[model samples]
Target chain A: MKLYSYWRSSCSWRVRIALNLKGLPYEYVPVHLVKDGGQQNSDAYRAINPMRTVPTLEVTEGGRVHRLAQSMAILEYLEERHPSPALLPAEPFLRARCRMLSEMVNSGIQPLQNLAVLQRIKAELKGDDKAWCAYWIDRGLAAFQEVALETGGTYCLGDTVSFADVFLVPQLYGARRFGVDLQPYPLLTRIEAACANLPAFQAAHADRQPDAVPA
Target chain B: MKLYSYWRSSCSWRVRIALNLKGLPYEYVPVHLVKDGGQQNSDAYRAINPMRTVPTLEVTEGGRVHRLAQSMAILEYLEERHPSPALLPAEPFLRARCRMLSEMVNSGIQPLQNLAVLQRIKAELKGDDKAWCAYWIDRGLAAFQEVALETGGTYCLGDTVSFADVFLVPQLYGARRFGVDLQPYPLLTRIEAACANLPAFQAAHADRQPDAVPA
Candidate 1:
């Protein structure tokens, strides 16, 4: 499998964590999100993912290729395609609960604070970028933190490192980048620490990636 | 089954479509989103759905209601709870594809054009509300239109009215509200037409519901 990834992309980071959790060997193809007017918009990368987003996984076997998009979709794809360490629960309601947590973060929290939206607020609206980031990030984190406390134990879902944790780790990474304080979210903080202890999440951290930028 | 709904909410419309698709009988309990400073945020509704979001499916039997938030999560919950006339496909790859298409609009397109975000843009950034709505809605619909061309035929993911169509109908309705031209995207328009012809989508439309604000 070949993953089109960026060091700083939370979506890309989520996929990386899932791959490591499943112990799947994959090659990473970096698409620099911020350099040279965004490499994702380039013709080469766009052909791979028409969505023009990082983390389009190409699953290959004897020259047969399958191009996939979206981080949550890709994570679920991996779970189905390779099912040893189950990312989702077996029971229906439990599975729904797990997916709810993931979507809450993936759709609810992440998109509002995405780089594109941030750039839009800064450039077009002449809004204070710092405050805009803080506002949305803070609101999103608060929403996730509330749910995390209810269903979370060591992980977002329970004791196991399920798919929700895969999503939460990256969301936290993005929030911290904009200086959204994590002090208020105790459950989220604990879950993050538990996730960090796992090798899967540890290896997938932005700073540890091959294309990670030096501070 | 009882659906806590509002006519104008895209999320509520999603559940309405899903229930119709499955041929399930459910009473609609109108929850006015805007009336009384939004009924969803009140302690009563919040006790039912802590997220304080529209489209909370209240299972009448046992009053053991599942407080599902996020439209996608609710749809998936319905799929699991009632499997016949399946909204999702049997194959994992196809399932992922359908989910990706649904989410492209759900997470990517819809959030930027949401009521709160639009209000924020107007009040905080002092942006031209008309231009703001036009920009995000057009861009989002165009992107979905481009991608929908690939896996689309009649319905979003083919002849069967999958979960993707359930999501698309409401989003297109929202898009049309802001005057997004659907002519340029032939596939999307065709799909929307196919969806509208179905009783499920038609019955779930904004104008058809009791809570629909008078024009």
Candidate 2:
């Protein structure tokens, strides 16, 4: 398996954490989202993922290669295929809650502040893109904190690390990048501190990636 | 089960389609997105879902009420609990593809054009929200069409009415509402036509909802 990723992409980072959690090793192929007008838009990468997004997983099984994109889809595939070290809870309702929390980050927070949308704000709308990103990030984190206060324990769901944690950790990283005031989200910060101690989350940090650039 | 939904909300419409597809009878409890300053922002509704989004599914099991939000999460829960008429493919790769297509709209399209984000664009940035939505809807639909062309046969994943189709139909409806020229996406329009003939899709149309306002 090869993961086509950008070092600082939250979506890419989520998949990286999942792969580590599942004990699945894959070759890391970096697709620079910024260099040369976003290499993800290149024809070569678009063939692998027509959406021109990062974290496209290429897997070879039974002499056939399958490429999958979208972090949630890839995470679900990983959970389905590698269920031993589960990334979701056992009970149905708990699993649904876990996914609901994950989507709060995946669909709710991340998409509005991503590179392409920010670029559009800058080019087309002539808006303060950083402020735009920060506004959405702050709003989303506050809502996430409200929900996590109910479901969280050692992690977003409970003592065990679930997909909610997988989605939350990277999004918190993004929140900080956008200068979102994390002070309001104490529960999320506490969960982040807990996840920071885990080896899987440690290995998936953006700075540790092969393509990471020094600040 | 009761669904807190708003007519013309694509996310709400997606879950409505899923519930209909699974033969699950759910009470449609409408939450108006644009009446007297948006009822989804009410204190009562926010208690049910902190995200303040529509399509919150309230389910009763063993005397415990589990209210889940996020359409993908709700769809996954329904599929897990009631697996008779499956919404996913049997093969992991195909299932992944189906989900990949769904997320193309779920995360890629819908979030960027939803009411809250559009309101932000209007109030904060003073931008032409309609043009912003049209741009994103066009781009996302193009990406969906490109990927769907590869995996589509009758539905998005080869004649099966999977989650991909469930997501696509509402998104196309949103695109038309935004005045996006659909001539470029012949394949997607064809799939829309196919899904339109189905009873589930018909039952879940925004115009057919209890709270739908006459045009």
Candidate achieving the largest DockQ: 2
Measured against the true structure, the TM-scores of the candidates, in listed sequence, are 0.95, 0.99
Please, what are the lDDT tens digits per residue for candidate 1 over residues B41-69? 78898777766667777664465555667
lDDT of each: 0.82, 0.92
Q: Output DockQ, candidate 2.
A: 0.91
Worst lDDT run of 10 residues, candidate 2 chain A, spans A142-151
Clashing pairs in 2: none
Model 2's CAPRI class is high
User: What is the lDDT for A116 in model 2?
Assistant: 97
Model 2: how far is B33 from its true place, Å? 0.6
Interface RMSD of each: 1.6, 0.7
Provide the RMSD of all predictions against the true structure, rounded to 1 decimal. 1.7, 0.9
Residue range with the least summed lDDT across 10 consecutive positions in model 2 chain B: B147-156
